[model samples]
Target chain A: MNTDDLIDFLATRVEAVDPGRQDRLLTLAMAGSLCLAALACIFALGVRPDLLRAMGTFDFVLKVGFLAAMVAIAAHGLRRAARAGRASGKLLRLALLPLALVWFAAVMQIVATPATSGMATMFNDWFVCVLAIPLLSVIPLVVLTLVLRETAPTDLHYCGALLGLVAGGIGALAYASFCVNDAPVYVGIWYAAGLAIVTGFGWLTGPRFLKW
Target chain B: MSREPDLEALMRASQSGDAEAHRALLQHVSVRLRSYFRNRLRRSGAGTDDAEDLVQDTLLVLHTKRHTYDGSSPVLAWTYGIARYKLIDHLRLNARALRNVQIDEMDDLADVDRYEAVDTSRELHRALDTLPRHFRLPIEYVKIEGLSIAEAAARIGMTDAAVKIGIHRGMKKLAALLSEARP
Candidate 1:
């Protein structure tokens, strides 16, 4: 086909862009996601009674720090992922920085508290931690996908991975309040696993749902 | 006259379901992809129809993905990215399929005539279209179909010398046609 004729034929099928579509859609998506996750956390599992005490410890800061960093960095990537063929090359590095730091802290934490009586109990509820992170991420994942659908992303795998990071981070953050255990190693090991599972899910779904 | 050839403006109008704007956008995108698809297809020695097929498929992709175009990025980069990805997917699928033929059944599939007439055929390949049937058939059997000159001569019922000359003249004409196509 002649290029001109082909273009004319295709252009006739296009629909107009609505004013302020991207901004309006994203704003609602984030707000709705947070509200939904927070609600689920409150009704399903109340915040740990000792959350204030947990907040005062350095471990709380470190644990929350890792998740918060993931959320902040991944959110930045979400915007760029909106463009086709564009992906944040920094996402992996940004995600790893916090995780590595926490892992280091976990090592120090174990060395400092070795052979403690409560050490055996630390691994208790480990399954629950793994289950809760991705389970809790479902709503945010759905909500983020709604916004993602509105943007044109070319690299579906990278963009989907970034979305997974963002949704997983939010889930981990919400779960932090209910979680009383602040062992850096546990957070490093189990929490990291949970996030990985979420990220893997994102990668699996990227090609199917993020085609646009 | 049309106000101006504004792709972004056309995209904006397209979001509102305007067929005129959609047509303009498709034309603009197709003009760009013509070169994009041609470059890759030519590299693989694929026929011109392959390039047109890619363009049409891209147009459909753009239509389906129309809602995702946010207009914040350059339209060329956006469409070009999509075209590139489509090319990658096209190559990936073709590569796998071609691999089995090339490795496992190269002898049997060697020189298969892709130019054979099909009932549904509607367009001519630019390079082959200009040659007369006699010249075209000889060249195709010898070159594209991988038949030796004697083999082609036996098949076409012509002397090997005449078959060789037909192929040579046909090739010269095909070259002229291809050269003309470039500029």
Candidate 2:
């Protein structure tokens, strides 16, 4: 057949696709991510100590409320990411905002707590939070990375890298909110370290496993 | 509830969690997609079953990943990209199947038609190769790939008018080459 005929044939094949299945598949995929987010929230809340010492009753409520909101947003993002695999541009872009918020809150808590000369105190206060970064941040980062992998164009690799970096930055911000101390230097160092690690993870996994 | 909304607007609303918008968007695009697959099957000598299967697969991908589409870009570009990937995958699978079978056992008539189609296609490709890269791509994208003028224009960063003009000139040259080979 001539090229025109070939194209006409292809166009018809493309036009025949059922949009209903697309919606159903998207909803199912997103459901997996939402389930993950729910489990993560439960683990995070359970691990966190009582709010009685860190902040008063009102302050504690506010912090818990904020954390809940972050989780909700992340859940929404997870759902959206899964449903569209990579089709919806608006939801994909908007997802970054909540993911960033979650990271910001985490970082604040890390920086606000006073540094201690005692090895045990320092380890318990800062190290634990730092350790949890990879586990918690990686989940959402990996999810977004998967979505980006499936949806992103070949020419958008740079944008994808930049997206990883953004994910890292927001993660840093979430870390900051929980920190009691106000040391910008420590925040810069530890947060940057965490960001670099997660960004690297995204870069590595995004290309290989994320390809749709 | 009311008269149907525009597909683009429905997509935007659906992103914001409007159920009606989501339903409307799906209904509007489904018929167009069916037509697309049906036409492809007819031209390629494939059956309706294959076209229907592909249509279902493409739509499933589209619905699940609606969030990946940025409202800023044209909807067709985003959808077309998904469709292209699916088609390529289908072609690859078919090629693998053909490779597994014995080519020597194939009938001559089937072979002749395949050869003629490939031979003519090669001639057209070689003629296309003679054009400058800039002119060649626009023509291939618009004429050969069946992309809308707007999509071809956006992909190559050319204005719609420029893409149209380039395609016109390229087609004229291709036609001249094809006619020359007729004698």
Candidate 3:
């Protein structure tokens, strides 16, 4: 058909779009998926018996608190950057702040630990956690990417990494419930490593999966 | 492109499933697409009707993908992004068709490529002439010639870092000048 004629026809045929509705639907899907994932972990892996005791401690609070903060900041940034033409450096920095604090706390713990102290305690579950966090993040990470299919991301790779951070952050929080080791070093090393791996995975997949 | 228009409000209304708002938004985008495609086709030695066909395809894609457009994004960018993908798809289909037709003509095209490259290189040189020597040298060596940073550094008699900075600034200025020169 001719251009003008087609334009006239399209004028009548065009359907109203509801991006806000889609955004709300994405939220519902992600939240429901995370809940299901957490439940699965609890039922299959069993919550750590000392979880209640650990929750009451200051150190434990700080650890989970850092991850919680990551979820908050990353989630906010992900939502913003998911939009077109949104190159929000401020949001990226805001998301990194929580991670930086966690790293800082970990460094301080390393410094304070006696050089003579056995290395076994410090390295406990370090390798295992590096593997575990990414695996745990798979469900939520997939959910996040699926949710993002409805939105436009200008910097696809960065957006994927950001959402990966969100999933990893939330996944770590879920995993924490079953973990007994509350050391700053463990959280710093394992949690950070796990999220890094996921972020890397997102970077590789972002350009391919999130290109649309 | 029409920042003065209340695009956000219009977009929000469309997001609420207001048919009139949706129609208005689509019509607005359709107008922009017409001009965009016409300009692109003119530059690419294609017919204006190709623009219409592509624009129609873009709208269809947009209709299917409307829910993906987050309400907060600039409609222009989002719309253009989808248009770009549609353009790519169209080009790919055309390319495949042309490849079949040109099965025996590929060899002759090599000569055309060389001639075009020479003309392009001369034009590029003219553009580079406007840049300062410090910026131009590094860009020519590292960017155009595809020289390593160390090679560029040695040729320009500058540190690797200085060469990198010069190439960066030179490219940015060249891009600005080139874009300004174009419609």
Where does candidate 1 chain A have its weakest 10-residue lDDT segment?
A8-17
Chain A TM-scores in order: 0.86, 0.46, 0.87
Cα lDDT of model 1 by residue, A28-147, tens digit:
776678678867987798989998887999989999988888787887787777766553477667779888999898778677776574377569689988999998899889998987
Which candidate gets the maximum DockQ versus the true structure? 1
Q: What are the TM-scores, per candidate, against the unseen true structure?
A: 0.65, 0.36, 0.67
What TM-score did chain B of candidate 1 earn?
0.53
lDDT of 3 by residue, B138-182 (tens): 867765565777887997789988986786567556544432232
The segments of candidate 3 whose C-alpha lies over 4 angstroms from its true place after superposition are A13-17, A88-90, B1-5, B37-50, B67-73, B84-183
- Using DockQ as the yardstick, the better of models 1 and 3 is 1
Which residue pairs show collisions in model 3? A150-B68
How well is each residue in B44-117 modelled by candidate 2, as lDDT tens digits?
Answer: 66565555445545554555456566554566556666665555555554564466455653545654444444
Candidates' RMSD to native: 16.4, 17.8, 19.9
Best by TM-score: 3
Model 1 scores a C-alpha lDDT of 0.72
**If both were scored by TM-score, which would come out higher, candidate 2 or candidate 3?**
3
Docking class of 2: incorrect
lDDT of 2 at B108: 51
Assess each prediction's global lDDT (C-alpha) against the native: 0.72, 0.50, 0.68
